[model samples]
Target: MKNRWIALYVENQVGVLAKVSGLFSAKSYNLQTLTVGTTEREDVSRMTISVKADDTTFEQIKKQLNAMVEVIKVIDLTTMPIHMKEILFAKVFNLNNEGKTEAFQIAEVFDQGGNVKIVDIGVDSVLFQCTLTERKNNELITLLKSRFKKIEVTRGGAVAVESISSSCR
Candidate 1:
């Protein structure tokens, strides 16, 4: 199975998010990530969703989503040029000065024209915040888990938009 991306424009009304997400749950589709936000039109909202499925399953998912009343439109983005990013925060605990410095250095290495920064530092803890592609965020999490004994991670679902320039993730 491969990952597929989709963008849904839905009505911005009560129970819309629940109904949309419930469809996935009812169909037993493993939703990898889902992010929703209001658009320029207050009456509409856009949702960016990712799922792992084979071609047939992905097509079925699209059909099912399109049949939903609240879903105004569904755009398959798997092969399209788009830009995407996910928010990740990693907080390392029980750190010493050396460890804190190491965390800062690691963040710098990952920054490379991206948004990765040591947002917070305490006596024994440091927090790294990053806005990057989902895959990159996973790599950063893996690295932090390996280096730090005590760590906390929080991740936001990815948000994506059609690219006007070059394709990006």
Candidate 2:
């Protein structure tokens, strides 16, 4: 099935995530990614989800999601102008004093965008935090998976939508 990126603006309230997730689960939608956060307006939260669905089926999903009370708006940003970024935190273990070279090499992988920051480092563990587009972040993971023991990884689903022409950058 084709994939779609959808952005949802909703009233910031408890159970909002559950309500939207329920709709997708009920429809058997294959959710690939999701990200939610409070917007500039405290009362509004933005949600971005990536899912696989055919064109017609995707339309129905928008309809169903809109049925929920908290949902204020839903838009597919893939076709419109949009920018998306993903945050990744990874931990590497089994390091020693001699492994500094290898660790530096790994850090470079995430530093190109200058988003990767060394959050912490210890005798046997290295923690790195990074933010980039989903594609870029995944590529970095694939490159480092064999070199480091990626003990943990957490990603916000997706935050996407067409950019306003005046604000495009």
Which residue pairs of candidate 1 clash?
A: none
TM-score of 2: 0.87
lDDT of 1 by residue, 1-169 (tens): 9999999999999999999889999999999999999999999999999999999999999999999999999999999899889998989999988999899899999995759999888999998899999989999999998999999999888999999988555
Q: For candidate 1, give the lDDT of residue 87.
A: 92
Residue 74 in candidate 1 has what lDDT?
99
**For candidate 1, which ten residues in a row score worst on lDDT?**
160-169
In model 1, the Cα lDDT at residue 76 comes to: 97
